[model samples]
Target: MKKQAYNPYLPSWEYIPDGEPYVFGDRIYVYGSHDRFRGNAYCLNDYVCWSAPVDDLGDWRYEGVIYPKVSDPLNKDGSMCLYAPDVTVGPDGRYYLYYVLDKVSIISVAVCEEPAGRYEFYGYVHYADGTRLGERKGDEPQFDPGVLTEGDTTYLYTGFCGVGDRSRSGPMVTVLGPDMLTIVEEPIFIAPSEPFSEGSSFIEHEFFEAPSIRKRGDTYYFIYSSIVMHELCYATSKSPTKGFVYGGVVSSNCDMHIHSYKPARKPMYYGSNNHGSIIEIKGQWYIFYHRHTDGTNFSRQGCAELIKFREDGSIIQPEMTSCGLNGGPLAGKGEYPAYLACNLFCKDEEIYTPLEVCGWTAGSLK
Candidate 1:
C-alpha cells in the first residue's frame, strides 16, 4: 500500500522554513533555509534540501547539506546565517540558487549542475558597472529572493519593509540577463508598503517580506507574506512586474481569516511569521507553508494544503489541517501523534505563540 502524507512532511526533528518547491525532471525538490531545532536565532544551520518522486509525496529523501554557510566568500567564518532562498534553472540548464545573508542586503548566487547537488558560490547580482544590486546608490535592500527564468531573461523579486517604515519601499523586481547575475533592468516597486498603501488595493495586506513568483498560463502570481506576519497572501498580474492586484490569503499558520468552520477572527493555532509558495503536483495545486513549533518562532515545520481556483482565477484560503497532502481524509482511523494536531489552543484562548518566552522580539525578522 502507498504511504499517506501528513503535515510536517519531513522528519519531526527537521525545521526547514521558507520553502521554495520546484518539479525538476521526475522528482520535486524543496530548497529553503535550515533552522536549528530550539536555536536562539532563525536559519542558524546550513542550506539543506529534500526531494521525493513526483508520484509519491510521502517518500522524501534527504539530499544532505547541499550548500554550507562557509561556501560563500563573504562569510568564510560562517557567522552570518542564511536567509530564505529560491532556485531556478538558468539558460545553460544549470540550477541556480539565489539567497541573501542575514546581515547583508545584497543577493548572492550559487550554481550546481544538478538540482539537488552541491552548490558553489557563483557571484553576486550586480549591475553593468560592477556595483552590487543593493549596495548601489539609492537601491533598496534586497531580501528573500525569488526568481523565475524564461528564455534568456530572469525576473528577480526581493524586498523587506517593516510596518510604518518610510525608509524602505515595498517589494521590488529586477530583471536579470542571460548570465543570471547582471541586472538587465532597474529595480521597480511592484507593491505598496505599509506606509505607502493608503490608496492602493493592498492597503489591508501590504507586502512585508517573502516575495515569490509563479506563472500559470498568462497570469503571473505573486505570493508573499503580509504585514500580519501569520498569513501568506497572494496577488496576481498579467504582466511580470506591474498591475498586480491583491487577491486573498493563501494559507494562515493560525487559521486567522477562515470562517468556514469557526469564527473568522478566532485564531486556531499558535502562529508567527509565515513564508511559502504554491506549486502543482500531479495536476493538483497546493500551497506549501510553515508553522511555528516547539513553542518558539525559530523552530518551524512545513505543511501543505490542496488549493482550488474559481473560474475567475481567485483562490480560497485553506484552513490548517492534519491531513495535508493526503489528497483527502485519512483512510483508516488509528492513533496519531500529538504534533499533528492542527487545532492547538489552551484554556486561556491564546492566539499567538509567546515570543517573549522564547527570547524573540516582536519586530525581529531573523
Candidate 2:
C-alpha cells in the first residue's frame, strides 16, 4: 500500500491532551472557554493557553493564562469571560488577538510581543474618527472578532446580536490603525440579512456570529455559520467593505452535505461546528473551526479542514473528515468546480453544464 499524501487531521480533544485547541503556529494553542453547564459558581472561566507542536498534537506545553479577566472595575473584565480568539502576527511583528469579551458581546484587542505571553488589553479598536464604532448604549453589543489586511490597509470584522431580537447584527468591517489597537474606518456591513441564517446558535442567540475571512488572489472570501449551528456559508467581494453577495451553505452534518432547511439530526452535533479562522500554511488555505464534543458533558472544540477556491473567485468548502486544508494543495490538482461555473454575474443564466456531469468535482480544487 502507498503512504497517504498528508497527515490525518485531528479534532481538538483528540489532539491536545487537555482543553480545546484555539490557535496554531509552531504549536497548537488550547484555551478553555466558559461552558454554560457551570451555573452560578462565579462564571470566571479561566483561559489557560497551552501550546503543542503540530508535528505531535498529542503532547502540549502549558503556556499559562495569556489573558485573564483584569482587575479593572470599569471594564467588563470584572464579570466577563473570554470566548474563542483569533491570533495573528501583526505587520509590526507583535502578536495581536481579537476575541469575544463574554456574553455582553464586546470584541476587545490585546497584544503580546510574543505568541504565547500574557496579553495586555489595549482598549477598543475605535472608528476612523477616533470614536468607538459599534458600541451602542444600553446594548449588550456584539461578539467575536476576526481581523484581516489587504495591502497597506487593515480591517477588523466583528458581529453582534441585534436588539429586541435573536438575529445577529450581521458581520461588519472597520479599518484598524497600523498599531492594530484602534479603528480607522466606519463599520461597513458585509453580510446583511445573511441568507440561511435561521436557527443557528448564533441566530438563536440573536444573530450570525463566528466569522472567518480569507483572501485568494484578487478576491476575498468570508466563511460564516448559517441558520443553524451546523451550517457554514460564505460571501465574496472585490472590495472588503462593500458589495458582498451571499454564496451558499455547506453542512457538516454527517447525513447530508449542503441544505437550505432544518433536518432532524441538526442543531445536534452538540460539538456543533462554529467559531473558526483561515490561515495559509505552505501557500495553501486551511480553515480552523470548532465543533461540538460529546463527553459526559457536551462541549465545543476545534477542528481543521482544507479549503479550495473557485476560478470565478468563490470558496469551495467541502464536506467530510479531513485535515485543515480541506482536500489539500491545489497547485496541480485539477480545476475546481467553482471555476467551471461563470462568475456570480451569470447567476441568472442557465447556459451551463451540470456540476456532476462535468468532471468538476465539489471540493478543494485539483
Candidate 3:
C-alpha cells in the first residue's frame, strides 16, 4: 500500500483528541478520547486506538473500538463519558488503561490483554473502604490521567486544572501496587505550587489538566497543559510524586501564534487547549499534541513534532508544521484539505500575516 501522511496525522474523518502515545512491542499505539464528528458535547464517542510500526511513520492502522461508553459504570444512565487516558504495562504483564468518568467524578480502570485490544472494566482508584477517590476527596474533577510503572511499583497521576471547575487545584500523584487496581498510598499533591524558577511564585505553574509523565534517564518529566490554555509545559524531578521544578513550554496546538492568553508578541493559529507527552521512539524524541478544527474545541485531532534536548536538559520547542509524523516534509504535490493547517486565521484588519498563510481554503493552500 502507498503510505499517506498529513499534519493532523490521521484521516480527516477521524476526530481523536487528547492523544496519549504508548510504544508497546513494535507499534506506537495512540490511546485517546473520541470526539463526535462535528457533534456538540466533548468526548461523546467510545475509545478507539490507532497505531503504526516503529519503522513506518506513514502507515497508521486503527485498532477499532477498544471500549464503548456503555461499558462504564457512570454511563449506566447514559450520561457520563470517559476523558483523556493513559496506558501502562503492569507487573502482571497486562495493559492497564486509566481514565476518568467525567460526570461521576471518579477515576476508573480497565485492562487489556494486548496493548490495543478490548479492555474490560477492572476497578476504580479508591480508598481502603472502597469509596472512589475523586468522590471522597476535595471537589476536584477527576480528569486527564497520566500513569507509569517502575519495576513492580506503579504510579497513577490524575487531576484537573481550574479549567473545568475553578475550585480544582493542580495534579495529584498516588502509588498503585503490583495489582495495578488499588491505590496503595494517600494521593500526594505533586505540582503547580512547586517553584518553576528562582523567584517564581507557586501560582506561576498552575495546572490546566492533561498530565503526562515520562522517565528520561534519572529525571522524571511531568508534562501537562498549563493555565495558558494553548501550550504544553513540563516539570522535572528525581521522584515521580514530588519536588518538581519547571522545565518549559514544549509545544502549542495553536503553533504559538495569535493567542492572547500569555501576551504573545505574535499569535498562534488555532485558539485551543493542547495536551500530549514526549516519548523516545526508535531512539529519537518527539512531542505529541492535539489541534482543534471547525473553529470549535470539540473536534480536535492529534499532531506531533520531532524534538531534541540539549546537554543541560533544556527542550527546544519545535514549530508546528504540516510535515509532522511524516519525519520530513510531505511530497508537497497533492491537494489537501483546508483544516489540516495549523496556521490560518484572519487579522483584525488586513495587517497580520506572520505565518505567510494563503487564503482560507477553496483556492489557497493550508
Best by lDDT: 1
True lDDT of residue 72, candidate 1: 94
* Pick by TM-score: 2 or 3, better one: 3
Question: lDDT of each prediction vs. the true structure?
Answer: 0.90, 0.50, 0.77
Candidate 3, pairs of clashing residues: 257-267, 257-268, 258-267, 258-268
The C-alpha TM-scores of every prediction are 0.96, 0.65, 0.89
| lDDT of each residue in 1-366, candidate 3, tens digit only | 547566788888898888888888898999899988767778988899999887887788988999987777667665777788889999989999988867666778899899988999888887767777776755355678899999888888887766335365468888878888667886887765333323543354567778889999999998988777777888888999889877888887665632333345455464567788998899988888887766567888888888989897878878777767776766768677776666664543122222233344332223
Q: Compared with the true structure, what per-residue lDDT tens digits does model 1 show for residues 171-261? A: 9999999999999999999999999999899987999999999987799999999999998999999999899999999999989989998
lDDT, model 1, position 256:
92
Q: Where is model 2 more than 4 Å wrong at Cα?
A: 1-44, 50-62, 71-78, 103-105, 127-131, 136-140, 150-152, 161-169, 194-207, 250-255, 258-273, 295-298, 322-366
Q: What is candidate 2's lDDT per residue for 1-366, written digit by digit as tens?
A: 221222123323332111223345566664435343313321245455656555444354667668766622235445665655666667777777676655445566778888778888766666555544446543235556666754446777777433344444467777776777666665666665434345432333223666666676676767666544455566777887877667654334221342334343332222233555555554555555544322212344345556676777555654434333333442445433332111122222222222212222232222
Ranked by TM-score, top first:
1, 3, 2
lDDT: the better of candidates 1 and 2: 1
User: What TM-score does candidate 3 get on C-alpha atoms?
Assistant: 0.89
Question: How far off is model 2, as Cα RMSD?
Answer: 11.6
What CA RMSD would candidate 3 show?
A: 4.4
Runs of candidate 1 exceeding 4 Å displacement: 356-366
